[model samples]
Target: MSTAYVLVEQNNGQLDHVTAELITAARVLGEVTAVVVGEPGTGQGLAAELGALGASVVVAAESPSVTGRLVLPEVDALHILAAHNPGPIVLSANLGGNEIAGRLAARLASGVLCDVVGINADRTADQSIFGDTIQVSAAVGGASPIYTLRAGAVAGEPVAAAGTLQTLELPAATAKDVTVVSATPAERGDRPELPQAKVVIAGGRGVGSAENFKTVLEPLADVLGAAVGATRDAVDLGYYPGEYQIGQTGVTVSPDVYIGFGISGAIQHTSGMQTAKKVIVVNNDEDAPIFDIADLGVVGDLFDVAPALLEEINKRK
Candidate 1:
């Protein structure tokens, strides 16, 4: 079987939620080789987990440079691997992943497919384009096809493999590379990360004010244990932080349940959450565009409905 290289994304020590999905996607192509670019021992640490997730081999490219600098170290590691054992490379379709994919493709002179939702046996991929209004199939004609898969696009299933460990030393950083002097981790609340959350509760301009987001939406989210999201407009209006924005210019989410409160259903926002397994929208405007795709729609004021829902859920709890 051909080898499929999956770039593993991890933080601190825990593997990112997308890593399993990437491994699952790689299985469709051939034997899975999971690549880890981090500090020493990172790959060894994840080998068993990777094997459990269907990665037959785990290539741990450990070096201080990986954490000390930006993007280049990962590119260097993948480039070196491809030089000897070239195959399809799969990465998460996030900001950093896309940049790495572009750089790696340029270095290898290969074609790349970004934001791919599905990969077929024939190697063609399904992509949602034009703000997700169009679904198109894309194929790359090259020795190596680098694909950046959208988060939550593929569900991960365990198919155990050997998970043999291989360590590679990354080249030393050069003057051309950017260096990280210091960093401060963002304070993420107790809620699960938005992309990986099974349930998400999003608010919009109709949420009224920042206080309402804290009072109305947050209480609902707490009851449901759902991640909180906001439309670009809500973010722009300072009702929520930009990092929590869900739309074309922001994060793409595919939760099992996506609940939007007071959103107008703009294409930009829907495109991000359209892949959600079940969509529920609460909008006073019955004709709101969001209702077009909602699995459940409630025509009511979010402030009123949200509190009642929260109270009822609290009762049930």
Candidate 2:
């Protein structure tokens, strides 16, 4: 049977949720083999969890010095391992994964199914694209086809599977030219990561000011245990961090529920968040474009509606 390699991601010894989702998708394709690129202390029981999720092979490279270094070794490993025991390759279609996918496809000289929402292999490789528009079936040339899966696009299910562990120890490659810099993780609440969050509460310019924005959206996210996002207008006006923006100029997310306040939906803006499973729009203008795609819409002044909504949510809590 063909083997599918799922590159595992761990932060502070805990597996990233995207890795779990990838393993779940791998079960639908073929035998799953997990690859972990970190020091021994990082994975905890993540590997075992992946095995329980149907991964039959687990590969580890425990290099302490190489732990956070952005090196080309990952792409190099893909070329080396797949050359001898060639099969399907799976990676999270996040920012980091896209970089590795590009390098691996170039080095391996193979076709890449990138930003693939879902993958199916019966007679051909069928993949769903971003922007909620296209689905394409693809073929590879001489090498095994590499694929990158979108976050939150598929449900994760893990089955019982005994895994064979392998460690391919390669000599450390040259460090990246970028200088070592002090790293500080941003302070956030217990909220879920933005892309992986099931619920997203967002703001826009209509919230009036930076202070007003927190009044409207943050409370809702807190109630829902959701991540906070902003429209390009809110981001440009400095009402929220640029990282919180969720339109064409911002991050693309497919959360279960998305709430947009005061944002006039431009196609560019919608292009990023249109994949959301449910959308709620609150704006003073009933004719606003954001309302066009909203499953639920409220045509009222945000200044009046937001406080009431916040109070109701607080009362419910």
Candidate 3:
């Protein structure tokens, strides 16, 4: 059977949720191995978790330069491991993950499938293309294929493995033309992150203003413990932060439930979230394109429907 390597990502000292999903996806292709790159001791701590998700072996590489220099550090580590044991590589479809996948694929001279939503029974990667109006399956012939899977594409199930952990020695850092001089952390809040949240509640141009978002959407999001999202129009209007914008040019998410308030569901916006398992839209315009994809549509003013829904949810709680 084939062996697939799952590159695990972590944040705030815990395994990134996508790691589990990658492990699950890898098993679909073949036997699964997990590769984790982090500071000293992160791999050992994460091995058990990766194993529980069906990783037969875990390779951990320690590097202080991981977050310091861009994607080279990760590519260097993968190059070493792949040299000895080459196989299909799976990674998450995020900013950093895409960079690493691209560089690594170039080094390996392998074809890469990006933002794949599923794996075919024949191991080809399934992708949503052209604003999700088309679906395509791609296979890499005569070479190991690198795949960057969208976060939340695969539902993870724990299937225990031996959980063997091994350390990979990183090579000397290569000279770089550019340097990372400074960085600022994002604002931290109690809510789950937009990409990883199982439930996402988003506001759009109809939310009116930032104050209205705070008054209407914030409470509903708080009650449901969901991450908040915004459309490009809302973000341009300064009703929400740029990071909250969901579109082809913004964050891509595949949540279990996506609830949009006053969102018209432009193709740019739908491209980012069409994979959601259940889409519920609340918009006044009955002809809004969002309802075309929604599993449930509430054609009413969000100001009235949202508060009433929250009240009902609270009463049930």
Candidate 4:
């Protein structure tokens, strides 16, 4: 079987949930070779878990440059690996992953497929395009087609493998690379991360104000243990932080239940949450487009509906 390189996403020594999904997807193509690029000892720590997830080998490319510099180190590391054991390269389709895939593809002069949902036996990929309204099959012309898969595109199934560790020497950094000056971690609240959350409560411009997001939507979310999300308009209006924005340009979430308040159901926002199993929307506007896709649509003010929902849920608890 051909070797498929899967980039392992990690932060502060903890593996991201997407890494397992990448491994599972790569297994459909060939043997999985998980690649970890980070500070020294990062890969060593994650090898066992990667192996349990079906990675046949773990390539740990550790260096101080990885922590001090930006995306260039990753691009360099993957480029070097592709030079030797070239195959399908898989990565998450998030901001950093897309950038790395694009740069690496340019460096390797290979074709790249982004936002891919499935990999066929013939090596073609299935893509949801045009706000996910269209499904297309894509194939790369050259060897080692780089793919940036959407999160939740594949469910991970564990099939144990050797997970043999292989250390690679990263290429020396050049002047072209950007240098990091300082790093400050974002303050994380108790709520689960938006992308990984099983339940999501989102708001839009109809949410009225940031105060409303705090007092109204958040209370309901807290009761349901759902992650808080916002439309681009809400974020732009300063109702919520940009990181909480859910849209085509923002985070893509596939949750078991997605409840929206005051959203107009713009295609950009709907595309992000389209994979959700159940969608419940509340909007006073009777003709809101979001209602078109909602499993349960409530034509009522969110301020009234949200607090009532919160009270009922709390009463149940």
Candidate no. 3 TM-score: 0.91
The Cα local distance difference test for each model comes to: 0.90, 0.75, 0.85, 0.90
Q: After superposing candidate 4, which stretches have Cα over 4 Å from the reference?
A: none
lDDT of 3 by residue, 1-317 (tens): 77788888876458877888888888877788888887778889988888888999988888776666667767877777776777888888888889888888888888788899887647699987887789898887534678998876677777899889989877656676245778897777999888888899999999999999999999999999999999999999999999888877677778889999989989989988888889999999999999999999999999999999999999999
The stretch of ten residues in a row with the least summed lDDT in candidate 2 is 122-131
Off by over 4 Å in 3: 177-181, 254-256
Model 2, residue 250: distance off in Å is: 4.0
Model 2 alpha-carbon miss at residue 151, Å:
1.8
- Residue pairs of candidate 1 with colliding backbone atoms: none
Worst 10 residues of 1 by lDDT: 64-73
- Please write out the lDDT profile of model 4 over residues 184-289, one tens digit for every residue: 9889999999988999999999999999999998888888999999999999999999999887878888899999999999998998998899999999999999
- Return the lDDT, model 4, position 4: 90
lDDT of 2 by residue, 166-209 (tens): 77764565645233456787786687877788888888788878
| Model 1 lDDT at residue 304 | 84
Stretches > 4 Å off in candidate 1: none
lDDT (Cα, 0-100) at 173 in candidate 2: 55
